[model samples]
Target: MKDIFTNLYNKVIGFFQAEKGDSSKVIASNRLKLVLMHDRTNLDTLTMQKMREQLIKVISRYIEIDQEALDLNLEGEGDAIALMLNIPVIRARTLEEIEAIEKAEEEELAQKAAKDAEEQEDAEGSSDESEETEKNTKDSDESGNAEESVISEEEANTEENLQNEETNETEKQKVKKK
Candidate 1:
Protein backbone atom coordinates (compact mmCIF):
# COMPACT_ATOMS: atom_id res chain seq x y z
CA MET A 1 0.00 0.00 0.00
CA LYS A 2 1.00 3.63 -0.30
CA ASP A 3 1.35 3.93 3.47
CA ILE A 4 3.88 1.07 3.55
CA PHE A 5 5.99 2.74 0.86
CA THR A 6 5.87 6.04 2.69
CA ASN A 7 6.96 4.39 5.95
CA LEU A 8 9.86 2.66 4.17
CA TYR A 9 10.92 5.92 2.54
CA ASN A 10 10.83 7.70 5.87
CA LYS A 11 12.93 5.05 7.54
CA VAL A 12 15.60 5.26 4.82
CA ILE A 13 15.62 9.03 4.89
CA GLY A 14 15.82 9.10 8.66
CA PHE A 15 18.74 6.74 8.68
CA PHE A 16 20.76 8.86 6.24
CA GLN A 17 19.96 12.10 7.95
CA ALA A 18 21.30 10.90 11.33
CA GLU A 19 24.64 12.35 12.50
CA LYS A 20 27.41 10.26 13.96
CA GLY A 21 26.99 9.29 17.66
CA ASP A 22 23.49 10.78 17.89
CA SER A 23 21.49 8.81 20.44
CA SER A 24 18.24 10.47 19.45
CA LYS A 25 18.41 8.81 16.03
CA VAL A 26 18.70 5.39 17.65
CA ILE A 27 15.75 6.09 19.92
CA ALA A 28 13.64 7.24 16.99
CA SER A 29 14.55 4.13 14.99
CA ASN A 30 13.60 1.89 17.92
CA ARG A 31 10.26 3.64 18.24
CA LEU A 32 9.58 3.23 14.53
CA LYS A 33 10.43 -0.45 14.72
CA LEU A 34 8.03 -0.84 17.69
CA VAL A 35 5.26 0.88 15.72
CA LEU A 36 5.85 -1.39 12.75
CA MET A 37 5.85 -4.47 14.96
CA HIS A 38 2.61 -3.43 16.61
CA ASP A 39 0.98 -2.82 13.24
CA ARG A 40 2.05 -6.27 11.98
CA THR A 41 0.79 -7.99 15.13
CA ASN A 42 -2.65 -6.32 15.15
CA LEU A 43 -1.89 -4.74 18.55
CA ASP A 44 -3.09 -1.23 19.26
CA THR A 45 -1.17 1.50 21.06
CA LEU A 46 -3.42 1.52 24.11
CA THR A 47 -3.09 -2.23 24.60
CA MET A 48 0.69 -2.03 24.33
CA GLN A 49 0.79 0.79 26.84
CA LYS A 50 -1.41 -1.09 29.33
CA MET A 51 0.71 -4.21 28.93
CA ARG A 52 3.82 -2.20 29.69
CA GLU A 53 2.26 -0.71 32.80
CA GLN A 54 1.07 -4.07 34.14
CA LEU A 55 4.45 -5.65 33.53
CA ILE A 56 6.14 -2.86 35.40
CA LYS A 57 3.73 -3.19 38.31
CA VAL A 58 4.22 -6.96 38.66
CA ILE A 59 8.01 -6.77 38.33
CA SER A 60 8.23 -3.89 40.75
CA ARG A 61 6.68 -6.02 43.51
CA TYR A 62 9.82 -8.17 43.71
CA ILE A 63 12.41 -5.53 42.95
CA GLU A 64 12.76 -1.76 43.16
CA ILE A 65 13.12 -0.62 39.56
CA ASP A 66 14.01 2.61 37.78
CA GLN A 67 10.67 3.14 36.05
CA GLU A 68 11.90 5.95 33.83
CA ALA A 69 14.65 3.84 32.27
CA LEU A 70 12.57 0.71 31.49
CA ASP A 71 12.36 -0.43 27.87
CA LEU A 72 10.00 -3.06 26.44
CA ASN A 73 9.80 -4.15 22.83
CA LEU A 74 8.66 -6.95 20.60
CA GLU A 75 11.11 -8.29 18.03
CA GLY A 76 10.58 -10.81 15.21
CA GLU A 77 12.85 -13.82 14.91
CA GLY A 78 12.14 -16.28 12.09
CA ASP A 79 8.32 -16.50 12.33
CA ALA A 80 8.09 -15.89 16.01
CA ILE A 81 7.85 -12.73 18.02
CA ALA A 82 9.88 -12.27 21.19
CA LEU A 83 9.25 -9.76 23.93
CA MET A 84 12.37 -8.00 25.22
CA LEU A 85 12.37 -6.13 28.51
CA ASN A 86 15.20 -4.06 29.98
CA ILE A 87 14.66 -2.80 33.51
CA PRO A 88 17.17 -1.18 35.85
CA VAL A 89 16.75 -2.63 39.32
CA ILE A 90 17.59 -0.75 42.51
CA ARG A 91 17.04 -3.56 45.04
CA ALA A 92 15.44 -6.98 45.20
CA ARG A 93 13.21 -8.32 47.96
CA THR A 94 14.76 -10.85 50.28
CA LEU A 95 13.40 -14.41 50.26
CA GLU A 96 12.53 -14.30 53.95
CA GLU A 97 10.39 -11.19 53.54
CA ILE A 98 8.54 -12.65 50.57
CA GLU A 99 7.98 -15.92 52.37
CA ALA A 100 6.67 -14.15 55.45
CA ILE A 101 4.19 -12.18 53.39
CA GLU A 102 2.96 -15.33 51.70
CA LYS A 103 2.60 -17.13 55.02
CA ALA A 104 0.59 -14.28 56.48
CA GLU A 105 -1.74 -14.21 53.50
CA GLU A 106 -2.27 -17.96 53.72
CA GLU A 107 -3.01 -17.75 57.45
CA GLU A 108 -5.53 -14.99 56.85
CA LEU A 109 -7.30 -17.03 54.20
CA ALA A 110 -7.37 -20.06 56.49
CA GLN A 111 -8.89 -18.01 59.30
CA LYS A 112 -11.57 -16.67 57.00
CA ALA A 113 -12.47 -20.17 55.82
CA ALA A 114 -12.67 -21.39 59.39
CA LYS A 115 -14.98 -18.54 60.33
CA ASP A 116 -17.26 -19.24 57.40
CA ALA A 117 -17.44 -22.92 58.31
CA GLU A 118 -18.26 -22.14 61.92
CA GLU A 119 -21.09 -19.86 60.87
CA GLN A 120 -22.54 -22.51 58.60
CA GLU A 121 -22.38 -25.10 61.37
CA ASP A 122 -24.10 -22.78 63.78
CA ALA A 123 -26.88 -22.14 61.31
CA GLU A 124 -27.41 -25.84 60.76
CA GLY A 125 -27.36 -26.56 64.50
CA SER A 126 -29.95 -23.90 65.30
CA SER A 127 -32.28 -25.21 62.62
CA ASP A 128 -31.96 -28.75 63.92
CA GLU A 129 -32.71 -27.66 67.50
CA SER A 130 -35.81 -25.76 66.35
CA GLU A 131 -37.05 -28.83 64.50
CA GLU A 132 -36.57 -31.00 67.60
CA THR A 133 -38.44 -28.48 69.77
CA GLU A 134 -41.33 -28.40 67.33
CA LYS A 135 -41.52 -32.19 67.29
CA ASN A 136 -41.58 -32.34 71.08
CA THR A 137 -44.37 -29.75 71.21
CA LYS A 138 -46.45 -31.71 68.72
CA ASP A 139 -45.99 -34.94 70.66
CA SER A 140 -46.98 -33.28 73.95
CA ASP A 141 -50.11 -31.82 72.31
CA GLU A 142 -51.19 -35.26 71.05
CA SER A 143 -50.64 -36.83 74.50
CA GLY A 144 -52.66 -34.01 76.15
CA ASN A 145 -55.59 -34.66 73.83
CA ALA A 146 -55.52 -38.34 74.74
CA GLU A 147 -55.50 -37.52 78.47
CA GLU A 148 -58.47 -35.13 78.06
CA SER A 149 -60.50 -37.81 76.31
CA VAL A 150 -59.82 -40.34 79.09
CA ILE A 151 -60.91 -37.83 81.76
CA SER A 152 -64.18 -37.09 79.89
CA GLU A 153 -65.01 -40.80 79.68
CA GLU A 154 -64.48 -41.25 83.46
CA GLU A 155 -66.81 -38.30 84.22
CA ALA A 156 -69.58 -39.69 81.99
CA ASN A 157 -69.48 -43.08 83.79
CA THR A 158 -69.73 -41.43 87.24
CA GLU A 159 -72.79 -39.39 86.15
CA GLU A 160 -74.56 -42.55 84.90
CA ASN A 161 -73.92 -44.32 88.25
CA LEU A 162 -75.37 -41.40 90.25
CA GLN A 163 -78.54 -41.38 88.15
CA ASN A 164 -79.02 -45.14 88.69
CA GLU A 165 -78.66 -44.70 92.48
CA GLU A 166 -81.26 -41.89 92.57
CA THR A 167 -83.80 -44.00 90.58
CA ASN A 168 -83.36 -46.93 93.03
CA GLU A 169 -83.93 -44.63 96.02
CA THR A 170 -87.15 -43.23 94.46
CA GLU A 171 -88.52 -46.80 93.86
CA LYS A 172 -87.72 -47.81 97.51
CA GLN A 173 -89.61 -44.74 98.82
CA LYS A 174 -92.66 -45.68 96.70
CA VAL A 175 -92.55 -49.27 98.07
CA LYS A 176 -92.42 -48.00 101.68
CA LYS A 177 -95.37 -45.63 101.08
CA LYS A 178 -97.47 -48.41 99.53
Candidate 2:
Protein backbone atom coordinates (compact mmCIF):
# COMPACT_ATOMS: atom_id res chain seq x y z
CA MET A 1 0.00 0.00 0.00
CA LYS A 2 2.85 2.37 0.81
CA ASP A 3 4.65 1.51 -2.50
CA ILE A 4 1.40 2.13 -4.45
CA PHE A 5 0.96 5.49 -2.75
CA THR A 6 4.60 6.46 -3.47
CA ASN A 7 4.19 5.44 -7.14
CA LEU A 8 1.01 7.50 -7.47
CA TYR A 9 2.73 10.46 -5.84
CA ASN A 10 5.67 10.17 -8.30
CA LYS A 11 3.33 10.08 -11.28
CA VAL A 12 1.53 13.21 -10.04
CA ILE A 13 4.88 14.95 -9.63
CA GLY A 14 5.94 13.90 -13.14
CA PHE A 15 2.72 15.32 -14.60
CA PHE A 16 3.37 18.66 -12.94
CA GLN A 17 7.07 18.64 -14.02
CA ALA A 18 6.25 18.24 -17.74
CA GLU A 19 7.43 21.19 -19.89
CA LYS A 20 4.54 23.51 -20.80
CA GLY A 21 6.32 24.92 -23.85
CA ASP A 22 6.31 21.70 -25.86
CA SER A 23 3.15 20.05 -27.13
CA SER A 24 2.53 16.59 -25.65
CA LYS A 25 1.75 13.31 -27.48
CA VAL A 26 -1.82 13.55 -26.18
CA ILE A 27 -2.29 16.82 -28.06
CA ALA A 28 -0.81 15.39 -31.30
CA SER A 29 -2.89 12.22 -30.92
CA ASN A 30 -6.04 14.30 -30.44
CA ARG A 31 -5.27 16.33 -33.58
CA LEU A 32 -4.58 13.15 -35.55
CA LYS A 33 -7.76 11.59 -34.22
CA LEU A 34 -9.84 14.46 -35.65
CA VAL A 35 -8.08 14.20 -39.01
CA LEU A 36 -8.29 10.42 -39.18
CA MET A 37 -12.03 10.40 -38.32
CA HIS A 38 -12.76 11.88 -41.76
CA ASP A 39 -10.52 9.30 -43.44
CA ARG A 40 -12.15 6.45 -41.55
CA THR A 41 -15.72 7.62 -42.11
CA ASN A 42 -17.03 9.94 -44.83
CA LEU A 43 -20.04 10.82 -42.62
CA ASP A 44 -21.03 7.26 -43.56
CA THR A 45 -19.19 4.52 -41.69
CA LEU A 46 -21.01 2.02 -43.91
CA THR A 47 -19.39 3.48 -47.04
CA MET A 48 -15.95 3.37 -45.38
CA GLN A 49 -16.61 -0.27 -44.43
CA LYS A 50 -17.59 -1.00 -48.03
CA MET A 51 -14.39 0.67 -49.24
CA ARG A 52 -12.21 -1.50 -46.97
CA GLU A 53 -14.10 -4.58 -48.15
CA GLN A 54 -13.65 -3.60 -51.81
CA LEU A 55 -9.94 -2.86 -51.33
CA ILE A 56 -9.38 -6.33 -49.90
CA LYS A 57 -11.33 -7.85 -52.78
CA VAL A 58 -9.15 -6.11 -55.39
CA ILE A 59 -5.90 -7.19 -53.70
CA SER A 60 -7.04 -10.79 -53.11
CA ARG A 61 -7.71 -11.28 -56.82
CA TYR A 62 -3.95 -11.27 -57.54
CA ILE A 63 -2.58 -13.08 -54.46
CA GLU A 64 -3.57 -15.66 -51.95
CA ILE A 65 -3.92 -13.60 -48.81
CA ASP A 66 -5.18 -13.62 -45.21
CA GLN A 67 -7.71 -10.75 -45.17
CA GLU A 68 -7.95 -10.78 -41.37
CA ALA A 69 -4.20 -10.04 -41.06
CA LEU A 70 -4.25 -7.06 -43.42
CA ASP A 71 -3.43 -3.63 -42.02
CA LEU A 72 -3.86 -0.21 -43.57
CA ASN A 73 -1.80 2.21 -41.50
CA LEU A 74 -1.42 5.95 -42.01
CA GLU A 75 1.35 7.85 -40.22
CA GLY A 76 3.62 10.87 -40.48
CA GLU A 77 7.02 10.87 -42.24
CA GLY A 78 8.57 14.26 -41.42
CA ASP A 79 6.22 17.05 -42.62
CA ALA A 80 4.71 14.60 -45.10
CA ILE A 81 2.88 11.34 -44.45
CA ALA A 82 2.24 7.96 -46.08
CA LEU A 83 -0.52 5.36 -46.40
CA MET A 84 0.92 1.91 -45.70
CA LEU A 85 -0.92 -0.99 -47.27
CA ASN A 86 0.03 -4.22 -45.54
CA ILE A 87 -1.53 -7.30 -47.06
CA PRO A 88 -0.43 -10.72 -45.88
CA VAL A 89 0.20 -12.81 -48.97
CA ILE A 90 1.19 -16.49 -49.15
CA ARG A 91 4.93 -17.12 -48.98
CA ALA A 92 4.69 -18.71 -52.42
CA ARG A 93 5.11 -15.85 -54.95
CA THR A 94 5.93 -15.92 -58.65
CA LEU A 95 9.15 -14.38 -59.91
CA GLU A 96 7.00 -12.07 -62.02
CA GLU A 97 5.13 -10.60 -59.02
CA ILE A 98 8.33 -9.96 -57.07
CA GLU A 99 9.96 -8.43 -60.14
CA ALA A 100 6.92 -6.27 -60.86
CA ILE A 101 6.80 -4.86 -57.31
CA GLU A 102 10.54 -4.19 -57.31
CA LYS A 103 10.34 -2.54 -60.73
CA ALA A 104 7.47 -0.30 -59.66
CA GLU A 105 9.20 0.86 -56.46
CA GLU A 106 12.44 1.51 -58.39
CA GLU A 107 10.59 3.49 -61.04
CA GLU A 108 8.83 5.60 -58.46
CA LEU A 109 12.07 6.40 -56.61
CA ALA A 110 13.87 7.20 -59.87
CA GLN A 111 11.11 9.59 -60.95
CA LYS A 112 11.22 11.39 -57.58
CA ALA A 113 15.03 11.67 -57.78
CA ALA A 114 14.88 13.04 -61.33
CA LYS A 115 12.24 15.59 -60.33
CA ASP A 116 14.36 16.71 -57.35
CA ALA A 117 17.41 17.11 -59.59
CA GLU A 118 15.45 19.14 -62.12
CA GLU A 119 14.07 21.44 -59.40
CA GLN A 120 17.55 21.96 -57.92
CA GLU A 121 18.99 22.79 -61.34
CA ASP A 122 16.18 25.25 -62.03
CA ALA A 123 16.75 26.97 -58.65
CA GLU A 124 20.49 27.26 -59.29
CA GLY A 125 19.92 28.56 -62.81
CA SER A 126 17.51 31.24 -61.59
CA SER A 127 19.91 32.28 -58.79
CA ASP A 128 22.80 32.60 -61.28
CA GLU A 129 20.61 34.58 -63.69
CA SER A 130 19.46 36.94 -60.92
CA GLU A 131 23.05 37.53 -59.74
CA GLU A 132 24.21 38.30 -63.30
CA THR A 133 21.29 40.66 -63.82
CA GLU A 134 22.12 42.51 -60.58
CA LYS A 135 25.76 42.91 -61.63
CA ASN A 136 24.70 44.15 -65.08
CA THR A 137 22.29 46.65 -63.50
CA LYS A 138 25.01 48.00 -61.19
CA ASP A 139 27.47 48.32 -64.12
CA SER A 140 24.87 50.13 -66.24
CA ASP A 141 24.08 52.51 -63.35
CA GLU A 142 27.77 53.29 -62.91
CA SER A 143 28.13 53.97 -66.64
CA GLY A 144 25.13 56.29 -66.55
CA ASN A 145 26.62 58.19 -63.56
CA ALA A 146 29.94 58.62 -65.43
CA GLU A 147 28.08 60.01 -68.47
CA GLU A 148 26.28 62.53 -66.27
CA SER A 149 29.62 63.75 -64.85
CA VAL A 150 31.00 64.18 -68.37
CA ILE A 151 27.91 66.21 -69.38
CA SER A 152 28.26 68.48 -66.28
CA GLU A 153 31.94 69.11 -67.11
CA GLU A 154 31.04 70.07 -70.66
CA GLU A 155 28.32 72.47 -69.40
CA ALA A 156 30.79 74.13 -67.02
CA ASN A 157 33.34 74.66 -69.87
CA THR A 158 30.64 76.20 -72.07
CA GLU A 159 29.61 78.58 -69.26
CA GLU A 160 33.29 79.65 -68.75
CA ASN A 161 33.66 80.35 -72.49
CA LEU A 162 30.46 82.50 -72.52
CA GLN A 163 31.80 84.50 -69.54
CA ASN A 164 35.13 85.17 -71.39
CA GLU A 165 33.23 86.32 -74.49
CA GLU A 166 31.19 88.78 -72.36
CA THR A 167 34.38 90.23 -70.83
CA ASN A 168 35.91 90.78 -74.32
CA GLU A 169 32.70 92.42 -75.58
CA THR A 170 32.64 94.81 -72.55
CA GLU A 171 36.33 95.78 -73.14
CA LYS A 172 35.56 96.58 -76.83
CA GLN A 173 32.50 98.69 -75.79
CA LYS A 174 34.67 100.67 -73.30
CA VAL A 175 37.33 101.32 -76.02
CA LYS A 176 34.64 102.49 -78.41
CA LYS A 177 33.21 104.83 -75.74
CA LYS A 178 36.63 106.26 -75.02
Q: Each candidate: what lDDT?
A: 0.75, 0.67
Candidate 1: worst-modelled 10 consecutive residues by lDDT: 148-157
Residue 134 displacement (Å), model 1: 48
Best by TM-score: 1
> How many clashing pairs per prediction, in order?
0, 0
TM-score of each: 0.40, 0.31
Deviation in Å, model 2, residue 9 alpha carbon: 2.5
lDDT score of model 2?
A: 0.67
What are the RMSD figures for all models against the true structure?
45.0, 37.6
